[model samples]
Target: MEIDWIWGLLGGLLIGSGGAVYLLANGRIMGASGIIGGLVDGSGHATGGERLSFLAGVVTLPFLLTLMFGAVATHITGNLAVLVIAGLLVGIGTRLANGCTSGHGVCGISRLSLRGLVATCIYIAAGVFTVVLFRHLLGIV
Candidate 1:
């Protein structure tokens, strides 16, 4: 296997463990989508300052990681409009689903949640369908 695979696996393990710890300690779910949505909507129990800090940490962590490791982040060589549209779609989907892949696929699956199982299935199906539609049907690959 490649070194990148090892790193990916380790990172996933760390994230999953951290999420489990958060759930256990705080009696809260570690759903990134939910956290972001709550932060934006200001509907969650967390205070404004706490939400801002949490959101800031989420947004800054990737940059900090890249800086500390001297690793260049992957760049998408696609049209800017496509990227923006895709991002917006993903954000909307996450909000509608109440969580993202990390939340449902990892945390929810680990806890044997029915909603998580269904959500993860839908996420995978949507991803596969999108790839097929764009690359095969639309010849956009």
Candidate 2:
């Protein structure tokens, strides 16, 4: 029996819970872009250690999960240029949107923020359009 849905559901729960806990503990919105951006621009110097710890958990937890449950097939492309371009695009989009999917879709929506809702909608629409264009029209992605 496949446990894909189970894993996804659990991941969602964990993410939601983490956001809630972060909000309660830090009194700040749990936006990945904001956290990293502040650190990169030195605006969050006071919270640099906190941000580093959060990022460490973000990178480490997945590795630990794979170590415990074995690796899962991601079907990622092997092309380094494509990967770099994709990462750059994502970073740019996150900057433009002022948040990421986790920040707007999860935390912002949960808090019923209008800006978050609107940004989430726009990004989702853009994502759908991109997939349709690249996958169907251009056969790129």
Candidate 3:
């Protein structure tokens, strides 16, 4: 069968639960970029174990799922240059915003944070604009 809303619902619940657990257990926001950034910038050494464990779960769980359910192709472009440029752009955007969608959209909104709400709005708008501009207008993506 094709994808269904139930999978999305389950994923959302899992993400929200994980964010809540991380916040309650660590007393800190669970931003994926921030977690990895701390390691790259040497600022998260104090909590390196937690970060590493979280990262491990993030990577491993998806592989386990794919193993059980079969591979789900993203159908993304295989061009290395395009992929690298996209990665760099994402990193720059994430840094400029001070957080990613998970940080602002999930954790921040959950706590009624104004910044999070605003950030999430901006993120969604930007994503929509990008898709329209690239896929529809320019036909470049």
Worst 10 residues of 3 by lDDT: 90-99
Instruction: Report the number of the highest-lDDT candidate.
Output: 2
**lDDT of every model, 2 decimals:** 0.80, 0.88, 0.87
- Summed backbone clashes in each candidate are 0, 0, 0
Model 3 C-alpha lDDT per residue in residues 62-94, reported as the tens digit of each score: 999999999989999887877898899878777
lDDT of 1: 0.80
Model 3 pairs whose backbones collide: none
Location of the lowest summed lDDT over 10 successive residues in candidate 2: 89-98
Give the Å shift of residue 63 in candidate 3: 1.0
Ranking by lDDT: 2, 3, 1
Predicted structure 3: lDDT: 0.87
Q: What is candidate 1's lDDT per residue for 24-119, written digit by digit as tens?
A: 876667788887788777777555555566568777988898889887757774778778888899889998888898788888888899999999
Residue 13, candidate 3: alpha-carbon lDDT? 96
- TM-score of candidate 3 on Cα atoms, chains taken together: 0.90
RMSD of each: 2.2, 1.7, 1.7
* Superior candidate under lDDT, 2 versus 3: 2
- TM-scores of all predicted structures: 0.84, 0.90, 0.90
